[model samples]
Target: MKFLKSGLEALDEVTVIALGSNMAGGYPSSEALLEAALARFPGARLPVLARSGWWRSAAWPDPGEPEYRNGVALVETSLRPRAVLEALFSIERGFGRTRGAANAPRTLDLDLIACGREVIDAPGLVLPHPRAHERLFVMGPLAEIAPGWVHPTLGRSAAELVVTATVGADAIPI
Candidate 1:
């Protein structure tokens, strides 16, 4: 495993990973689950280069549900886009995530927000996650770590998009 060069926005190795957990499952808290989850990425070959602090945000489509703990990680990986996605899903399952009703609370939710500057749209994988820019939970932490990151399709930096994000408007750093 080699480093992806120094500094935040350099190197083509950069990729964005969104982390969310509303249910701790066996962990003590959602925050704890998220922290432990980040630690697992390196073993998956996606070493975390930079990470934002955990954020608290109301659950979407239903605010009455337990709030979600969210954050973003910038990692450097040589894996292709699809492989990167597969690794993320595998990591989620290891933390007890299950596929059920859409948006159901879960022990862990790992999303591949972007793969370098790759703009991909295909079955089972979507780069720069279709709705990620519209969600504060994603954009907020992204802004904290890589404020200048421009979406492949949206054409705006995280710092710029976070202002107008339509979902999770109540999101705030914990």
Candidate 2:
């Protein structure tokens, strides 16, 4: 961790993380699994500052599967973007999330939506998640928690993006 002249970590970044789940696995319900996953953020060094209530939406590409429970989290942390991504992946794994088919039902899905104002496009990481701004499941909850959060690249607030989100339009707070 790099300390600034004022004693703040260079990585004192308040970030947005999007959470989603459709399969409960062993938990009683997907919503319960989501709550459990949020509880782990603090242990991962990403303490949750605020979070939106869980929203529900039919599974995309195949509504025949299961409905998804999604929400957004605002966390205060000292971890850089890459480390934040790693922590999210680790949390997902600890919840029995398996990497298999695309769009498959998942026990937990944690996405690093934005890391402050930094813009990064790496092989396995992308700041402000590439398509997050286009998904209502991601944006609606975000607008609920942080309406003024601006997309690093697009320069649009979460409230603005929610109106035009093309995907996940069926999402509604549950």
Candidate 3:
């Protein structure tokens, strides 16, 4: 996903990320992850309230394990999308996350490049998260932070997409 550097340009930009942990050594709890992120991005202004806690969703490419505790985070950062994603990977590794397989459960899972002001399709990332419009975990938290934020490509709001997306309501707060 692409991000605008200036606050003026990013005013309307929205970013969403999926949070989950169920891999080896187990994933750090949402609260812990949030705390870590804040510490790393000291001066960064986060979304008013990142929607998180717990949820159950179909395990992607990989299945048959415990359901994931999922949510989303809204953040305003000056770092480019790729740079931000690299930071997320570093955090995951610090939390004992290992790349066992694609879609495998992880101790700390962070998928960046959720959505932004511009449509970007890059080697390591894709704008709008490819499925942000179809997943509630990503959209739910995004809505909490940027309800009016419009999708650069679809021209839809986070809340609207999440409400219309197909997802199980069994995802409850921890």
Candidate 4:
């Protein structure tokens, strides 16, 4: 592993994180909330290297819900896999996300899409995001920043995955 200037073993791992928001609840607009949430990454020890423009898409499983603003960010961090996951959760909570139903609309959503070439299948965290390849919202924004990024588990590039995404046809660049 690489070491940072502070002598800490830098996680040195590049991670792709998917950002989404629908209902703002008490926050600003969904897109604004997403942007603000991303802004916190750098302060949380996750420095963003690149990010995609916002994309709009209908909420999954429940199209009746408000459309979601989606984007993807490439970040570098020195934290462990689980620590990274926890950080994401913390960010979500900071934005007023609540744990209720699966795929439910919320103020913010952060998904850890991938981390370097690591493949993790732990209980609470899964690397390369289990459903990333199938979600157009995720793949479209991910392709914008890292088209050549390969999914460790699927062995396919983000661009390729976007071409075959079955559910994201409604995703449009905003």
Candidate 5:
């Protein structure tokens, strides 16, 4: 058995998937995003953490709406980063995520290229979340699962970033 050897060598990188769902209505949330991902990727080993409290962040130029309920997940998969990203986007679209806003409250969002063992700043993706070190909501939940996973560029771990980033000071654990 022979393998195709191109300029790009066989990349053996682990996948770190992040899942986030949006809240619908004012009371009974109509969005069901995370549950759907779980159904699709069963036996996923990453810890699924969530935060229910919505924070009033700068809206992403969409229709001004309610704050967003966000969370993060750390998954381990063999699929390449791009492949995983596509899968996540498909999941987001399934939950009604439109590219209408830069920071709008969404029904569901699955940011697949959050972090990895190495730093990757590509055209469409930036590893370690690029802003992971700045967002508490992401750091908090990511810390729960990948405390030891270090940031390729920052020389820090998820736990460190979460504590350093105070944005999630009022995150409601769910």
Candidate 6:
């Protein structure tokens, strides 16, 4: 675990996070919701160091749902991986997201795509987000902010993975 001198000791790794939203009912526009969610990170204890421009893409595995607005952020924090995940969940809830059917439309989605070079496989949290490298939605935004970041397990850089991603070909700048 690398520690930054931000007055915190034994801090966990810096992480890249992916944010997306497709549901707009009962809330602001999906794009606005994403922007608000990113803005709230600092208040939630996860300070964003860098961010990518929002991208619009069709819903994964189910195009019947509303289109999604996606983006990625680089955050530096002292919180552990699980703690960071919990915070993300809280942020989602704050944006009116509710747990439901798998891959169902959501108001907000926040995924911790990578944490430095750490590879964790705990019960609930998986470091480097098991499928990040294979998903265009994740890799596209990630490449924009940290193109040189290498996958801890795959030995591939974000830029490399983005080139090979089979999905997200339809993603467009928002």
Q: Pick by TM-score: which candidate is best?
A: 1
Report the alpha-carbon TM-score of model 5 versus the true structure: 0.69
Off by over 4 Å in 3: 1-11, 24-63, 167-169
Which candidate would rank higher by TM-score, 2 or 6? Answer: 2
For model 3, what is the error of residue 125's alpha carbon versus the real structure, in angstroms, after optimal superposition? Answer: 1.8
Task: Give one digit per residue, the lDDT tens place, for model 6 in 4-120.
Answer: 233212113458889999987565688888888988999988998778888999987899889999988878888888888999999999988899888889999999987777889
What ranges in model 5 sit over 4 Å off?
A: 1-14, 25-32, 42-64, 113-115
User: Where in model 1 is the C-alpha error above 4 Å?
Assistant: 1-13
Give residue 60's error in model 2 in angstroms. 0.9
Which candidate number would show the highest lDDT if scored against the true structure?
1
Per-candidate TM equals 0.93, 0.92, 0.72, 0.90, 0.69, 0.89
Residue-wise C-alpha lDDT for candidate 2, range 5-43, written one tens digit per residue: 222232235688999999998899999999999989999
lDDT of candidate 1 over 35-85, digit per residue (tens): 899889999999898898889999988989999999999888999999999
Off by over 4 Å in 2: 1-13
Considering lDDT, where higher is better, how would the candidates rank from best to worst?
A: 1, 2, 4, 6, 3, 5
54-108, model 4: which lDDT tens digit per residue?
A: 9999888889999999988878888887888889999999988888999988999
Candidates' RMSD to native: 2.9, 5.4, 5.3, 5.4, 8.9, 4.9
lDDT, candidate 3, equals: 0.60
- Better candidate by TM-score, 4 or 6: 4
Task: Give me the runs in candidate 6 sitting further than 4 Å from their true place.
Answer: 1-13
Better of 4 and 6 by lDDT: 4
Give the whole-model CA lDDT for all candidates, comma-separated.
0.88, 0.87, 0.60, 0.83, 0.53, 0.81
